[model samples]
Target chain A: MEFTLISLLNGVTYGLLLFMLCGGLTLIFSMMGILNFAHASFYMLGAYLAFQLSAWLGFWPAFFLAPPLVGVAGALVERYGLRRAHRHGHVAELLFTFGLSFLAVEMVQLVWGKAVVDYRVPPSLEGTLFTLYSTSFPVYKGFMMLVSVGMLALLAALLAYTRTGLIIKAALSRPDMMQALGHDVPRIFTLVFAGGAALAGLAGVIGGNAFVTEPGMAAAVGPIVFVVVVVGGLGSLLGAFVASLLIGILQTFMVGWDYSIIDVARLFGMQLHSTSALTRLSLTQLAPIMPYLLMVAILIFRPRGLMGARS
Target chain B: MLEVNGLHAFYGKSHVLHGVTLEVGRGEIVSLLGRNGAGRSTALKAIMGLARAEGSVKFKGEEIAGMKPHQIAWRGLGYVPEDRAVFPDLTVRQNLLLGVKDPKAPGRFRLEEMFALFPRLEERALVPGGVLSGGEQQMLTLCRTMMGNPDLVLVDEPTEGLAPLTVAQVAQFLLEIQKRGVSILLVEQKLAIALDISQRLYVLGHGRVVFGGTPAALRENAAVRKEWLEV
Candidate 1:
């Protein structure tokens, strides 16, 4: 029971982090129709920037400044790189961002080296939040949840209540119409891309210390982020949120489970051979690939995703 | 209020509008009559900067030829496309609100005035735009543009695919727009409606102006009608 409770809490914390990354990706995709292959790279850049900033200016200042700096970098990339590539069509734009991801990794390696950076949770949030039986939840996890939930609420309010949010929504489906209605469509695109990058950067600020801050970090978490986006549906924010939590919880629980296919089969009175590798492989071993499996299932069953308007 | 001189537009390699020249006076309802593929819509797009065009497009004495669509719009030019490009996910009220350029700067039309113009829109104010009926969407689009309070409007096929009642309502709306001192450059197919409402008319044929005269002169010119307008 304690295991379930602790895993659920941990899962939620992890899910919110995933949402922080995927939210920006989904927003950028919906607005620009570009899947932004470099989004996770920006997340990595954020972590590295935070690591460097915290070293010089302390954690709080680094936390506040890193995301906007990443946002400015994203804006420059959109205005200079993606905008030019856009003239050649979607393939060129995709290739540009795909190339950008590689460039970001190389740049990070050159500046910060290939080794993991020592980024730690701030002293204030370093201790335990609560004890769940024998397991104590860290205060940093609680802080992460608070920040993620706060970001989500702010984003929702901005989109729902503000004029700029209304305009962004209109531009999502009808950018040309938006232009005709006196909106600078290209500028709006740049702003959205920047905003998306900022969200990812903010995620990295909180997530970097929680996980390992390394050059390989973006690549490690990148594919799972895509899985979350796909399973949530391509452009549906709500779908991404639901899928993030679901995948996070599923993976967490699976990682803790010791049961294998053979054990489950035995329970059903059809024991598999112990010599078979597939039957002997434990659920804990399969946790990493579970999101991909879920994505495949969702694609097969509901191609448009859970709440996606488009297929 | 709008003058297009020697405007040449292209759709990639294929040139669509060839030296199309036209003029719309202040508070005038000028209709561009043509069959499909006559570059009637292209003329509006070029003037609004939605199409790649070269030449002079002057709006209210300012040269707007090389301006972006939003810049042209800010110069007080509005365009309503044939497709009625409503943001499907936004609520009807939100759709109208998006038309306002600056919430602080007062426009010619208000939300209450639009709702009064079409009570159907107010009834479905909270509903998403995708679910609206054809007539309702048309009203919403027209009202949305009006919310910007543009000095001149380029309307493309406003009555296309609409029912007879809706068509009459659209005609009434056009007259109402004219009454508010906004000039209209209308791309219309129905000659009767054009003749009834338009102060002047131009007929487009093969990417050029084939006819330009008053409605009475157009009524008298059967040859121009048979060759360029009647399909």
Candidate 2:
């Protein structure tokens, strides 16, 4: 029971982190119509950048500085790379982004190399927050939760209240109409792309100390973020949030469970196990693949996803 | 005031508009009448810079042959597309707010004045644009363009797929706008409404202007109508 409860909290933390990254991807895709394949690379860059900055200025100042630097980099990529590939249609844009991810990963490897950087949390937030049945939650994670909540509140207000936010929401629904109404839509696209990168960078600042900060971090995190976006539905931020939490919790719980399909078969009194892959499966082995299974099922049953409105 | 001379537009090398020339004086209502595929809409699109074209287009005595759609819109030119482009996810009031070009400074049109003109929009002001009926959507599109306080409007097929009573309402609306000193270059199909509202008429046929005259002259010229406009 203690293991289950601790894992649930862990799952929520992981899910919120995913939401931070996933939210930006949704905004950029809906407004700009490019599935930005290099988003996690930005996250990886954020982690490295923040790690380096933290050594000089401490975590808080690095946290403040890293996202904007990443945002500027994202803007330049949009101006010089993605915008240039736009004339050839969506496929070319995707290829450009795909190429960009490789370049970002390689650049990180060149700068930081293969060793995992020791990105420790600030001593101020390094202690445990609370204890439950001999299990303890770290203050760094608690701080992460607080930041995630703050981000969600900020995002909600921006989308609902501000003029720029209103225009972005309006543009997501009708881009041509936005352009026809005298709005500089390409500029809006650049802003959105930069904003998304900034968000991923923020996530990296916190996630760097939590997870291993290395060149391979983006490759590990990128595919799962794509799953969250897909399962959440295309062009829908709310769906991404819900999907992120659900996948996060499910993956966490799956990792905790010791048995799998073979155990369930034994409960049903079925003893016919003749070297089949399904019978040999363990929940430990199944944890990583559960999100993909859910994605496939959602695609087969409801292709629009839980909260998706795209027709 | 606007003038077009020898305008030729192409949709990826398949010529859609050929040597179309027309003019509109300030506060005047000029109607471009034709059947489908006759390039009546194309003329408006080319002038709005929504289509690729090469020609001499003079507005306010300055040549504006090539400009982006947003640039034209910013320069006091308004275009209401045939599809009635409304942001469906936005509230009707929000839609109206988007039409306000200079949000910092007041313009010729006010929200209350627009509501007074169309009480139905006011009643459904908080509702999302997608839920509005076809006629309401049409009214929203027109009112939205007018919210920019444009000097000239390129209205495409204002009376298409509308009831006769609603058609009269739209015509009244256009006249009201004209009374406000806004020039109109209208693309309309129903010959009766076009004749009733327009100060001048240009009939297009096969990407060319086949006739240009007053409503009375157009009524008398049965050959032009039979060749260019009549189904």
Candidate 3:
């Protein structure tokens, strides 16, 4: 019971982090029709920037400053780089972002070195928030949950209540119509790209210290983020949220279970098992690949994803 | 007022509008009548900056030929596309809200006024635009454009695929729009409705204006209609 409760809390915290990344990625995809392969790279940039800023100015200042800086970088990228590639079509845009991800890694390595950076949670949030039987939940994790949920509420309100939000929702489906309605479509595109990058940066600031701040951190989390977006559905923010939580919880629970396939089969009254590696594989060993399996299943069964409007 | 002189629009290498010339005077409804490929829609697109075009497009005496679509729109031009392009995921109210250019500065049209004009829109204000019936979508599109409070509007095929009763409602809506002092450059296929609503009519043939005159003058000339407008 203790294990389940602790794992559930950890899973939700992790899921919220993934939600931060997925929200921006899905929004960018819906608006620009580009998957933004460099989204995770922006997250990495956020972490490195936060690490540097925190060293000089402390965590609170770094927390506020890093995301906007990343946003400016994103705006510049859209205005100068992505906009030019956009005219050449989707493939060119894809390749441009794909190349950008590599460039970001290289830049980070050149400036910050390939080794891991020491980025720790703030002293205020260093201790445990609560004890669950024998297990303890860290205050930092609670802070992370607070920030993520706060962001989600803020985003929802902005999209639902504001005029800019209405225009963005309209532009998501009909950019041409939006332009005809006196909206500067290109400017909106730049703003959205910047906003998306900023969200990713915020995620990086929070997640980097929670996990590990390193050059390989983006790559490590990148594929799983994509899996969440795909398994949720393209361009559906709610889908991304749900998928993030689902995958996060599933993977966390799987990692906690040490039982092998043969042991499960034995419990089901099928004790005889072969010496094959698949039959003996533990759930903990399979946890890392579980998201991929879910993605594959979703693709085969519901190609449009959990809430995708189109196939 | 809007003016298009010697307008030539192209889709890639294929020229769609060749030297199409037309005008919409202040507080007037001018109809562009033509068959499907006669460039009626392209003329409107060129005027709205939706198509690649070369020539002079003057809006309220300002030369806006090379401007982007949104720039042209800022010059007080509203466009109602042929496809009834409503943001399907957005609520009807949100769709209308998007049309307002400056939310802080009130336009000539109001949300309340739109609801009054089409009570059906008020009934489905909170509903997603995709689920609205075809006539409701058309009404929403028309009202959405009006929310911008444009000085001159380019309305393309607003009555296409609508029921006869809805068709009458659209014609009535156009006249009502004119009553509120908004000039209209209407692109329409239905001859009777266009003849009824328009102050002047321009018949387009093979990307050029073949006839331009009052509705009475068009009624007197059957040859022009047979050559250009008759499908």
Candidate 4:
């Protein structure tokens, strides 16, 4: 029972983290129709940035500082890099971001070395939160949840209440109309890219210690984000959030379900040899791949995803 | 005031507008009339910087040949596309609000005034633009452009696909825009509305101006309309 509760806690926390990173990605995709491939790299950069900043002025200031820095980096890339690639078409834009991801990984390795950094939680948030059944929930994980919830609230408020938010929401429907209405559309695109980068950075700062903070961190968690976005659908925020939680909790639970393909064979009145391929297929081993399989199934059946308006 | 001297446009390598030239004096309504493939739409698009153009296209006496579309819009020109291009996801009110050139400044039109003028829009102000009827979308498009307080409007086929009653309403709105001291470069297929509203008219054929004169002069000449404008 404690194990189930702990896994649930772990799942929700991880899901929130995924939402933070994926929310920005979905917004950018909806607005510009470009799947920003370097999004997770920004998250990785955020962690490394926080690590460097925390070394100088403790973790709190690093939290405050890292996101905006990543935002500026993203804006510069949007203005100087992506805008130029836009004329070549969507494929070129995708290639640009893909190349950017490779560049970001190389840059991280050059700056921080190829080894993992000692990016621990601050001394203040290092303690444990209230116990969940027999399992103790850490204060840091609670903080992460708080940060994600806060960001979700902030994003919701920004999109619902602000002028820029209204424009972005409108842009999702028709981007060309925005230009005819006397808006600086290129500037708005830059702002969206920057905002997405900032969210990813925030995710990185919160997620660094929660996961391993290393050069390979972006690649490790990056494909899963694509899975989240694909499973969430192309242009829906609510879909991203729901898909994130579903995938997060699902993968965590699958890891706990020690059932193997042999058990299914036994239920079918068949006996599998120990060395057979079916015998080696365990749910725990398939946990990481569950998202990919889900993506394929979703694509084959419901191409628009759960809440997507378009395929 | 706007002037296009020897304007040429290309959709990639396919040249569409070949030496099309016309003018709209301040506060004057000048209509561009032609069949579908006669480069009438291309002329308006070129002036708006939406199409690649070469040659002297001047607005308010300043050369605006290579300026971006939004930059041209910021300089007090507005375009109302033929399809009634409202942001479908936005509320009608939000759609109108998006049209305001400067949110901080009070433009020529008011939100209250727009709603008062078009009561149908006021009734459906909170509804998403996608759900509105074609006629309602036309009104929203006109009012939204008015919110910008443009010096001149480049209106393209405002009554296209609208009900006859809605067509009359659209015609009435075009006159209303002109009365408020804004010049108009009108593009329309309906000869009656163009002749009724325009001070002058230019008839285009094969990407060139076949006739450019007063509405009376255009009426007096059947040769130009039969050859260039008539099916």
Off by over 4 Å in 2: A266-278
lDDT of 4 at A6: 90
User: Model 4 lDDT vs. the true structure?
Assistant: 0.90
Q: Give the TM-score of candidate 1.
A: 0.98
- What lDDT does candidate 2 reach at residue B113? 86
Which pairs of residues collide in candidate 3? Answer: none
Q: Which candidate is the best by DockQ?
A: 1
Fnat by candidate, in order: 0.90, 0.57, 0.95, 0.71
Model 2 docking grade: medium
List the candidate 1 regions with Cα displacement exceeding 4 Å.
none
Q: How many pairs in model 4 have backbone atoms within 3 A of each other, for residues 3 or more apart or on separate chains, i.e. clashes?
A: 0
Estimate every model's Cα lDDT from 0 to 1. Answer: 0.93, 0.89, 0.92, 0.90
lDDT of 3: 0.92
Tens-digit lDDT string for candidate 4 (A1-311): 88888999889999999989999999889888878898999999999999999999989999999999999999999999999999999999999999999999999999999999999988889888988776789999999999999999998999999998998887677666677678888888899889999999999999998888999999998998988888899879999999999999999999888889888688899998788776778899989899999999999999999887788
> Local error of candidate 2 at A214, Å?
0.8
**What's every prediction's RMSD, in angstroms?**
1.2, 1.8, 1.4, 1.7
User: Which has the greatest TM-score?
Assistant: 1
Model 3, range B28-111, lDDT digits (tens) per residue?
999999899888888888888888999999898999998999988888999999999999989999889889988888899999
List chain B TM-scores, each candidate. Answer: 0.99, 0.98, 0.98, 0.98
The collision pairs in model 1 are none
TM-score per candidate, in order? 0.98, 0.96, 0.97, 0.97
